[model samples]
Target: MARKASTRRRPRSGSSYRRVKKRSCYFCDSKISYVDYKDITLLRRYISDARAKIRGRRSTGNCQRHQNAVARAVKNAREMALLPYTNQ
Candidate 1:
């Protein structure tokens, strides 16, 4: 008598089985970095919907200190009108 071969199950359609990789913070890796509120271009990337919230360490791959700095800089930028208070 012949044995039947085992079949692997297929994943469901439109389902994603892989974990998405998190992005790293640009500043932390550079090391010579200092976050300045005055740098509008630099601060804009972190802002979402015209408000800045420090991205999670896993998401941005930034250390706690740098994330705090990013938040501070974003606030200052908003106050100074370098960045908008809310997205239009």
Candidate 2:
């Protein structure tokens, strides 16, 4: 039987020394207890500029608690007209 090609990429020989840096939570480092909807500047950082969508925890590097708070704050801000519902 013929062998099928795998979807996964094979690592190049002798390039295994690369290390990924760990992401740290910004809110935890800054000692923030709550996310404020009225803080447009702060909220903007966690939003996608092109799509006006809430970024995921993996992308934003936010802890679980802070990510939840960020989601709520983004929703409230949008409802209050402080933030846009979409880029359009």
Candidate 3:
């Protein structure tokens, strides 16, 4: 015979790491109208530690619009020698 599913409310796993809050876009929250390619300090935070590449939208918590801006800015910074293309 097939078993019927229980209707009782169950508690989630007690994993603290699973309780993380969603991150908002930094530029959007800061109300920054434009992303400057020359801002190396600010741009550095958006780069990955291992590959020295621009972070992805999921990791950076950036929306589509701001993520695109960040990518363009990173590229420009690379071309201008402000940020390294790759880590040695």
Candidate 4:
């Protein structure tokens, strides 16, 4: 089941990391309106290195619009055999 977007995960107990600052969207900064499915290098940055899953908005610092675009691009790339569905 998917967790609600409104609810946030609690910080780990006794962790060194504390509060995290919000990050600016990369697409907005670059002024890139379109996300290219063929851009493997660029798309790979948004994907998990180990699990091959898409990274959340918080992790990638992507805006909602761009994040959706990224996910679509990834799926297209996968269908084209340009990117592996899983790293393994």
Q: Could you say which candidate leads in TM-score?
A: 2
lDDT of 1 at 79: 80
- Using Cα atoms with residue i matched to residue i, what is each candidate's TM-score against the true structure? 0.63, 0.80, 0.78, 0.78
Q: Across residues 19-66, which tens digit of lDDT does each residue of candidate 1 receive? A: 577776677678837898998877766766444454556766677788
Candidate number achieving the greatest lDDT relative to the actual structure: 4
For each candidate in the order shown, give its overall lDDT on alpha carbons.
Answer: 0.73, 0.93, 0.90, 0.95
Give the clashing residue pairs of candidate 3, or none: none
Better of 2 and 4 by lDDT: 4
Quote model 1's TM-score: 0.63
Model with the higher lDDT, candidate 3 or 4? 4
Between prediction 1 and prediction 4, the one with superior lDDT is 4
Clashes of each: 0, 0, 0, 0
- Model 3 TM-score (2 dp): 0.78
Model 3 clash tally, residue pairs:
0
What's the CA error at residue 63 for candidate 2, in Å? 0.6
lDDT of 4 by residue, 1-88 (tens): 9976867687676768677789999999999999999999999999999989999999999999999999999999999999999987
Q: Which residues of candidate 2, in runs, are more than 4 Å off?
A: 1-16
Per-residue accuracy of model 3 over 1-88 as CA lDDT, tens digit each = 9999999987687674366677899999999989999999999999998789889988999989999998999999999999998997
Error of 4 at 47 (Å): 0.4
Tell me the lDDT of model 4 at 5: 81
Q: What is the C-alpha RMSD of each candidate to the true structure, in Å?
A: 7.1, 2.8, 4.1, 9.4
